[model samples]
Each structure stands twice: as structure tokens, then as C-alpha cells.
Target: MSAAPPTVFGIARLGKRTKDLTKRLQPGDIAIIDHEDIDRVAAEALIERHPAAVLNVSASTSGRYPNAGPRILVDAGILLVDGLGDEVFEGVRDGQTLEVAGGEVLLEGDVIAHGTDQDDVTIAASLEIARAGLSEQLELFAENTMEYMLRERDLLLDGIGAPEVRTVLDGRPALIVVRGYHYKEDLATLRPFLRENRPIIIGVDGGADAVLEAGFRPDMIIGDMDSVSDRALRSGAELVVHAYRDGRAPGAERLEELGLGDEVVLFPASGTSEDIAMLLADEKGASVIVAVGTHGTLEEFLDKGRAGMSSTFLTRLRIGSKLVDAKGVSRLYRQRISTFQLVLLALAGFAALAVALWATPGGQALVQILGARLDALLSWFTLLFSPRATGS
Candidate 1:
């Protein structure tokens, strides 16, 4: 008879929203999410939490496009299982002990649901299929892009609809940070720029937390407020809620609960909060806008899984001339000071000081005292390393 399947055990953690779920995930916990065709950004977040395995209630990769999420998870040594349906949610509860034996999920030795065990081979096959059908996604993207331009032309061309915030951005560069991929690294690299220009800092959604993490308070926080923390919402930064076209603000209610209803300004617009922030900066006459952790590549846009990405594409097209990526700025703006240059500058300053000192009687006396101390230090060093000290 064949041996029974190997049961890998872990604590179950569930969240319907992958972004909110990742915040509470701990090492060795089994993350249960309902993410469909999980994007690279979500995969990266899960990887950060070091989960033992991920069990998805929906498709991990649909082969509609070559999403890098599942591939990233499997390669990072995290076990991925998908398509177990919503039955798993009903069967399992948070913090309960669960067993994953191949494609089957078990609780108390009873099978709850079964799914496909994703690996390098399976994910690779999915990516191959996705790439083969890339042309269709591109065609859809073109259609969406044209439709977006028409719907948002007034705001896109004239910056007509973006609401004004109290934060002053005129004639200065604005740094718009999003809590997306590689944001921490990009923020660290922009330290010099931050110190030099002191650009108006705007954080989108949870990006306010990122700004605080990087040791700066956000000048303004703009987003739907779904992912941001309560601390960030109360962080005293000017809050601009990204509301729907119908003027319904989800974030505003949360602020009201926090007793901050009077402080926020609702800005109704289409597209992602990332687009809203960039537009806001542009409308306020920011000389330049620097984006950190915002979508750039075609795959990234698709990974977002938003029809609003058409708005992002057009948003860039509208302000492409003034907007720059943080990576570009970090690469080009090399203002790092060298130790050798500092030493040389110090020597030059000392020489100038010595010359000026010699011109005055009191200054000359002070210089002589300093010169004696220097001679004594050199002589002591020389004596300490003298040839006579060696037995040879």
C-alpha cells in the first residue's frame, strides 16, 4: 500500500484583502488570502512576512497575462496552493492548526478543501501561457487608454477638478511616495535630495507610514484611507481624501470616527490615488514631481488589476515632462561628499588660518602654541616607532 501524504502543519491566518492581511502575518504562519492572479507587489509583501505557506481561495494566476507573483512566491521557498474555493474559509478559523498535505488542506485530520500545489514548474508553465496571450492584454490596454483620455480629458488637459490642499508646493519639487515595491530602498536613496531641497512630501494611502518610517512627517496624506493606519490618519498632515466621482468618500467616515472630519478635504477624481497625488502636485504649480514606488512597466500596471490604470497612463502623459522617478533622481543626483575631499578642505582651511594668524601678534602666539603641540605629537609617534626599539 502507498504511504499516507506528508502533512505540513501551520497556524492559519486569513484576510480577504491581501494588503491588510500582510500587516499581521508572522513567520511560519499559513497566510490564507482571496487574491486572484496575485500581483508581484502582493507576493513581495507576503515574502517579507516569511510565511510558511500561502493558501488562496481563488486563482493565483489566470494566464491572462504573465504575472510575476506566483513565480516570486514559489522561488522564495514559500509553498503556494490555490483554487480551493470559499469552503476553506468556512472550515478554517484564524489561529487554528491546519495541515497542508499536497493540494489538500486539513483540520483535525479532516479534509476541508483541496487545491493545486504550485511550484516552479507549474508557475513557469502559467507564465509561458500568459506570455503567449500578451497581445490580447495589449489590445485591451489600448482601448482602455483611449476611453480614459476621453472621460478625464478636462482634468487631464486643464487640471480642472483636483481640489486644493493647505500644503504649499509652488516653485518647489514635490515628492509623492506610495507604499509599493522597493519603496523603503528608494526612500533611503533619496535622503540627500530630501535634506537639500526639502520637497513637499505627499504620502498616498499607507505611504504615510512609509514616510514616518523614513524619519519624516508627511506634508500631506492623500488616498482612499483603506490601508493606512490610525496613527498615520491622526499624524497632523493635511489630509485629502480621494473620493469617487459621485462625491462619496469612504475615508471621510473613518476620519469622522477619529474626530477629524473638520480637517479633511475631499478631492473627487478618477484613477488611482497615485494619479490623484501627482495631479494635485502639478495643479499646485510644483516645479517637479518625484514619484517613489509607483507603477512604471506594462506588467506593473496590469499587476495593479485596475481599469483605472488607463488614468495612470494618461496622467503620466499629461505631466510626463515634469514628473521623474525616484530611481532616476538617485542615479543622476550624485552629491555625496568624499572623505579625501573633506581632509583636503580641512588642510586648506588650516593653511589659510595659519597665514592669517602670523599677521597678528596675539594670533601668532596662539599658532605657535598649536604648532608646538603638533611637533610633540609627531615626535612622540616617531619615538614610539624608532628603529632602536627593534632587537635587530
Candidate 2:
């Protein structure tokens, strides 16, 4: 007798990128993606959507580095099928009902694609291999950094074609927020600085939402506008849509459809949104740039599953002196009590002292003396009212 076949059922939603697909994904839907080396952020997003299962056409963990995406999905009890290949996409259409059983993708009782089902053992083994490849990734990162310096040398050395926006950043601090690792915690930590300095707030995509969540509005929002919420777009922040070097602006189209295109600014560049944001601030004459939740280290960039970080490296080189990470700022910034705060403190101290004196022995003696005086006055009134004393 043949063994029974395993079966998992859900509607399939397909996309070449995890981020793009997640926007349309609904609960209990199966996500079909071609994402290679899934990042932690992408995994978190998919988990948030509560998908039934994830089917990847490409390798979820390619042994490039110890990526946590697959582990995250599997640990969350979401079934993950790896290396199903591009054929899976052709076999399954968007919103088509499909069945997955024992690493086989089935379309109406037919096996469309065969893949390896990932579990704890396999994922852990892959992570070990990825850890071994970290050195190679580091070398490649260095090479890419050198190449970026050559390609973007002109822009880095000389501010060429930097867009001029209405937001004045000259000689002031600019807070650039990215919704990357620990952004909420970092934002909370910097609340004091935000209150005191009131730096120009620049939110990169979803970071706009973070700013709004932290009880503040962004002064400028710069990004592709895909991940950002509609609420953030209509936040009255000066919108700067990042365009490609060829002047293709997809974000602009989204803005126009939402009736917000009239006031939007188009900035055509060749770097990531966060990079552009830093350059925008630096070019606008900002004295200092404090970055919150921005990727700074090699591992951080790797976690995003980037082959290279050329633009980020060059952007940092250009604005090295002015740019500082949130951690550094939080550590170095010292809070000083203002004169008004000191005066308030003194007043509070006096009020506390008055309450303490009112509870003391001397305070009770003073009350008794006042009571005796009131009694004598009352006795005098009674005597005056008597018939003998009045000649009634």
C-alpha cells in the first residue's frame, strides 16, 4: 500500500519580492515569493499578515550569511517550502486556490512543483553554513565599497544636482528616521532631544508612520512611498518622491492617484531613500544629522540581504562629519536643567516644606492658641446677651 499524501490548503498570492506581495496579502492566504535570503524585517512583515504558509521560488537561506528570515517563519509555525523555482509562479496564478503536500505544490490534483520542506534541523544546518560564509561577504562588501567610491565620487566630492526643497535645514540638526531595527526604542530614547532641539524630522518610508506614532509629524517624507501608509502620505509633511536616474517616478504616480501630487517634489538619484535623505539634509546645510534606526554596520546591511552597500558607504563618506547614529547621540547628549525648571523645583520644595510644618508639634500649639481666642470672643458675646448685663 502507498503512503498517504500530506495536504495544506490556501489561496496563493505571488510576487517577485516579499515586500511588494505583503501589501496585498490577507490572513490565511499562501504567499508565493521569489525572495532569496529573506531578511528579518520581511519575515516580520509576512508574520504580521498571518499567512497560512510561505512558498519561495528562490532559496530562503542561500548560505550567504546567517539570515534569520526562514527561522522566523518556521518558528512562528508557518510552513515554508524552499527552492520551488520560477515554474511554481507559472503554475499558480494570483488568488488561485492551491494545495501543498509533503513538499509538492499541487494544482487541482496535479503536482506542479517539487521543493524541499524546511524544518528546524535543515534551517539550523543552513544557518551554520551561512555563518562560515560571513568572511566572503565581508570581502565582497569591501570591494563594493571601493567601486562605489569611484562611481559616485563626483556626487560625494561635489554636490551635483541636489534638489532644493522649501524645508530650511541650514545650520540646524536633522533627525533622519528609518523603520529598521529597534526604531521604536531609539525614538523613545531620543524624546528629550526631540523636545529640546526640535530638529527637522525626515522620515524614510514607514519611518513616517513611526514619527506619527511617537506623537510627532515629519517635516519631510522621502522614499519610494510603497511601504508607507496612506495616513503618512496625507500627514502634511513635504513629500519628496525618490526617482531613478532616468526620471522614472513610480511613487509620484501613487501620490497623483491619491490627489497629493500638486505639492510633491521629485528628486532623481541613484541611491537608497535613506541615503538620499542624508544627502538632502547635508546639502540643505544641516549642521548635524542624527540617524535613528538606520543601518550602520556590515551585519545590518547583510541582514537586509544586499550584495553590496555602495550607495550607503558613499553617502556616509560624504556626510561623515555631520552624521551621527542614534546610539551615539543618546550616549553623548547631556540633559541640562533650564532656569525655569530650577525655579519650579524650588517652588515645589517650598510647598513640601509648608505641608511638613503644618504636621509638626509647633503647628498644633498655634492652632490651640487660635481656638482659645475664639472661645473668649464667644463667651463675651453670651455675657452681653444676658438680661442683667443689658438693662432689659
Q: Against the true structure, whose TM-score is highest?
A: 1
| Candidate 1: clashing pairs of residues | none
Candidate 1 Cα lDDT to native? 0.89
For model 2, residues 1-392, the per-residue Cα lDDT tens digits are 95564468999999897877998999999999999898877898899899988999999999888888999999998989999999998878898998988899989998999998888889999999989998987788789888767755666778776787989999989999998876777798899889999999999999999899999999999998988999999989999998987889999999999999997898888768899899889988998999998887766788766776777888988898899888445445545789999999999999887677679999767767878999999999999998774555
Give the per-residue Cα lDDT of candidate 2 at 161. Answer: 62
Write down the lDDT of every candidate, Cα atoms only: 0.89, 0.87
| Count of residue pairs whose backbone atoms collide, per candidate | 0, 0
**Candidate 1 lDDT score at position 324:** 90
TM-score of predicted structure 1: 0.83
